[model samples]
Target: MPVIEIENLRKTYSMDGGLSVEALCGVSLCFESGEFAAIMGASGSGKSTLLNILGCLDPPTAGRYLLNDDNVAALEGERLAALRNENIGFVFQSFNLLSRTSALENTELPLMYNHSGLGMTEIRRRALAALDRVGLAERADHHPNQLSGGQQQRVALARALVNEPSVLLADEPTGNLDSRTTLDIMALLQQLNDQGMLIVMVTHEQEIGAYTRRILEMRDGLIIRDSPVENRRHARAEASGESTTRLNATES
Candidate 1:
């Protein structure tokens, strides 16, 4: 069975005139284990809506969502929160780190809520390991303000993975970074995907989408196309005598 499933999921936002704006119009999808996926769409194209539902941060208006075969649409309140905390990790474009906390402390925050019996020492150990995975272990003691934007983002990503959730949901992860930092983060995500982590990312940029195995494109609250990367695309770029620049690992 797929690790995640959605059946006819729909969400509508009601306006003042009793008119409704449908954000997701009964979209259905399933995610396989360890697959790297890119969710791409124009603005107002339901990418955020779909992501929000999948992350368990928002409920669908009408449809069935089965995550790990459990009826997610039927879950509510603390049940939904517990399920989300246990099964999903999120990396946002804004790098929403606590302003006053160190990187290690920020990464350790989630474990404090995981109900684990491990003490603070174990939590720090695990958080450091997660930071190492994202190549941010050296910045463990740095607060968000003390780090560069890219470094802060890496710290936020470390916090997301510290719990080892089943799915990693990233919304515009590279949107705020320069091109170089974007590739570094993309490479890190690729490495994680290769190591059997399921990743679902939302992006409007084709460069970032190229790193994923599959792309789901949306428009006007509907999925327009679901496809694999076209070989011709790479061929065309190469034909134009273009070269891709690599991100400097040490920058972040």
Candidate 2:
């Protein structure tokens, strides 16, 4: 079964004078396990709105969304929050780490909301493992202020991973990093996806989107093009100064 399934998803916003704006217009998509996909569009194209709905941050005005076959489109309050915490992990552009919290502590915060009954030792162990996966284990004791942008983002990624969520949702995760650091983060994300983590990312940068396996181009609240990347860029190879070649979509 697909990790995520949405059918005719719609989201509208109320404006002044009893007017409304349709942010999403019957958008439907599915993402399977281990798939790494990117959503790209210009400003006001509804990519952010779509991501918000997917992340469980907002409910769709209409339609169905199934995460691992559970209907979550209309879930609200504690139920929605619980479902989000249990099944989805989020990484944002701002690296939303607590200012004074240590990396390990920040990574452990998600577990506080978990009802799994895991003890502190197990929680710390999982957090450390997640940090190690992101190559930040050595920095676990450091605060966000003491780390570089890339390092802080890794901590954010580790925090997102600590819950072992079924789907990883990233919104402009590389937006604040330099090109080189962005490549590093993409490489890490690719590795995780290779290990069977479903990753959905929103990016406006074509260069960044090239790192993913599939691209969905959005326009005016609809996906205009959905195609597999013919010439998927390998960040490890790119970081080593290799010349990359592009292929036609049919070649994929």
Q: Backbone collision count in every prediction?
A: 0, 0
The whole-model C-alpha lDDT of candidate 1 against the native structure comes to: 0.87
* lDDT (Cα, tens digit) per residue for candidate 2, span 72-103: 96566788888778888999999999999999
Q: Rate the local accuracy (lDDT) of all candidates.
A: 0.87, 0.92
lDDT of 1 by residue, 1-252 (tens): 698989889999999989999999989898988988899999999999999999999999999998888899999778888777778989999989999899999999888888556698899999999999989999899989999888888998898899988899999999999865776677788778888989999999987898888899999888889997654123223323323322333344
Cα lDDT for residue 188, candidate 1: 80
Which regions of candidate 1 are displaced past 4 Å? 231-252
Pairs in steric clash, model 1: none
lDDT for 168 in candidate 1 is 93
- Give candidate 1's error at residue 226 in angstroms: 0.4
Cα TM-score of candidate 1: 0.90
Please provide TM-scores, in order, for all candidate models, with all chains considered together: 0.90, 0.94
Evaluated at residue 174, the lDDT of candidate 1 is 91
